[model samples]
Target chain A: MCGQNMLDIEGLVLRRGRRLLARRIDLRVDRGAFAYIVGPNGSGKSTLLRVLAGFGRPEEGVIRWSGRTIGEWGGAYRGEVAFLGHLEGIKPMLTPEENLAYRRLLVGPTGWRVPTPSPFFDASALPDLPCQRLSAGQRRRVSLACLEHSAAPLWLLDEPLTSLDHDGVAALGGLLARHLMAGGTAVVASHQPLPPTLVPATVLELGTKR
Target chain B: MNGLLGAQLRMIYRARGDYLAPVIFYVLVASLFPLALGPSPRLLSLIAPGVIWIDATLASVVAFAGLFRDDYDDGSLEQMLLSPRPLELIVLVRVFAGWVSLSLPLVLLAPLLALWFSFPPPILPVLLVSLVLTTGCLTLLGALGSALTVGLRHSLVLLPVLLLPLATPVLIFGAHAVLLAERGLDPRTPLYVLAALFFLALALIPKATAAALRVALEV
Candidate 1:
């Protein structure tokens, strides 16, 4: 039970150019916990998630994973994070399976069995076509499939619901529930409401207090 | 590592046009020199090493300038950054793939260009070896330039200005090696120096590229 809050940020400041977006912020999310970052446009929701995922530097403060600063954790920290930004990260020339396969391989061996073919996108329906041929929603689903195979304990999803259909949302809800049950943590930044099942989650609103 | 390499190779395979464009450009540029310089065999052979080297350098610069641009735009580079694998390792694999796809063809075609330039048969091997070293160095340097400018608009316009200056040492040594070999003198010293530069770039550029990419992502 020691170091229960596996993800911790202390006295954080985030700025976009000279304008301050978030300041003197503190956040902690334990394993299996869920946190929602909700705010209007340009509120730093995406920026916050990007910082949490170790992409950008916070203007001030430290982000600690499992009691170690992310820089100290280095590649070890990256091993535990699966970040999905607005771009989807899908190589359009590659099929969904190819994208997911390479995604899994890039993270190195997690000792987790290769996940049974992703339930997010049906192979029969979509076929083995290049992601370029897939619809935007289909591509989004393909990116979601990467999460299913990632085996990373922490997921920092920035607007993951973008372009997802109702069924896709339901599917994502199911995936989130299963992941939480399996002792995973998720920090999501979104404008849309998450499924009912994901309630009892901490909501961190940006741009309002300041 | 093999998986990353394989994936990159597959990308090169699928995007054949982008890789082939540089090779075709090298061929056209090299062929143009023979036509422009007239049929003087001595003059043709005299300029062969320098012309071939400059063409190869330009071709590689063009091909590799956008190396990280597409990946950066598509967000795949960010995923690569998130991987537990060292960023330097990923950068190395990517540059190696770019070399194999874009530069290797130029090397394979060097013999034909040598024959056209009427290069001495004995110096042909030297030409090939120097090109291999020079191209590898240029690709590594281009990868670094690509990483630095990936975040900016009009990065392609800025790429050559940043890369060509850094590539001069490689060009000088590589061309000088072939020129020496053509004159029946020992080309080993310049070749050795080219090899040292290649090895040194091989050791350092990937790390620098990785750091540049990390900073690029911060913006």
Candidate 2:
């Protein structure tokens, strides 16, 4: 995926109500690179992530993917990016396996069905249970499973490590390394350090410009 | 299209327990009015229209809470918002799912409730017709309410306040239709009005709900 920059943000500004969260920010995440976005609380890290993922439009500036403005990228084109916000985004009523299967159908290639034995087939073996009954770390793992299986070429994660244990964090780091190694790109927003193994990542500190 | 619809249906059915609870509440509420009014057939008949209409209206409001709360709590709403599918289409599926899980049962059980109130036999068809149309309108209205209160706590109070006023037309038409039917007069006028209201809601509410959800999510 490194032939071109998969994500480009220039002169981006985001505001919440009367407060200016971020201003005049420029960021770029190329194909196959892991980029980290860090800032203190209310630093607009989530805002920037939302804009980059095409969920929230920037107050001012342009976000482009592969040379086309994000707004210009139609549904099919934008589908190439997977976003995980602070919210776990997994339905509590659904089991871990069902959540993954549902998301697989949503963002997977059109006409794609969950494979007979899903990659996360192991999730089904644990128990027939609702996600709310699962531990926070377990829910996070289920969400990560969905992200891993998504065919999207770019990933935008907000606080992806919020509820993970040491092993879970390491597993996520492994997933990120594998994704990058496979030529996929990612922009992660977090206050925590990523696993040491995934190196040479570019870091952008929001609000540092002021 | 298939994915959005299928996901919505699955999510709604998974909350089957919550959905069924409101229908049971509706039956209980409808039954209490007759007993409280002392079982006088005249008194029961006199208030039956209002009783059924109130019961159905309250049931829809109660079920509306489950429409977006589960999805919001589970993070499913955020996931859907970011999906390749148009937000409008996704919101439509949600509204459809809410109707299927919450409102559909109420319509189906209207006959039984009507019997309990000893509604005139001739009025039964009109009651069912009014319910079918009103349920469609209520579902759309409820979707709008759900979108407004997406991430807020105490949404239970906010939902009814926002929805009940908007639902007045449905309640009015529904009760009137039942009254006309009981009089053995043609209830066609109110029934047609309710159908038109449902169509108007169907044409317009999904887009409104979608826009509301987008704004709510951005905040």
Q: Which candidate is the best by TM-score?
A: 1
Listed in order, each prediction's TM-score against the native is 0.95, 0.91
Cα lDDT tens digits, model 2, A111-196, are 23342233421466445688889888788888887787776778889998988888778878887777787678899988888888
- Worst lDDT run of 10 residues, candidate 2 chain A, spans A112-121
Which residue segments of model 1 deviate by more than 4 Å? A111-118, A121-125
> lDDT of each structure?
0.85, 0.79
- Candidate 2 per-residue lDDT, tens place, B1-219, comes to 677677778876776776789989999998888777787887787888888888888888888865776667767777777677677777787788778778888988888877777777777778888888988898888888888887788998888998999999999998898888788888989888999999999888888887877776774
Task: Name the best candidate (by DockQ).
Answer: 1
Considering summed lDDT, which 10 consecutive residues are worst modelled in model 1 chain A? A111-120
* TM value for model 1: 0.95
Per-residue C-alpha lDDT of model 1 across residues A7-66, encoded as one tens digit per residue: 787898988778899877778888888888888999888888888888867768988877
Model 2 misplacement above 4 A: A1-5, A74-77, A111-128, B1-10
Deviation in Å, model 1, residue A111 alpha carbon: 6.8
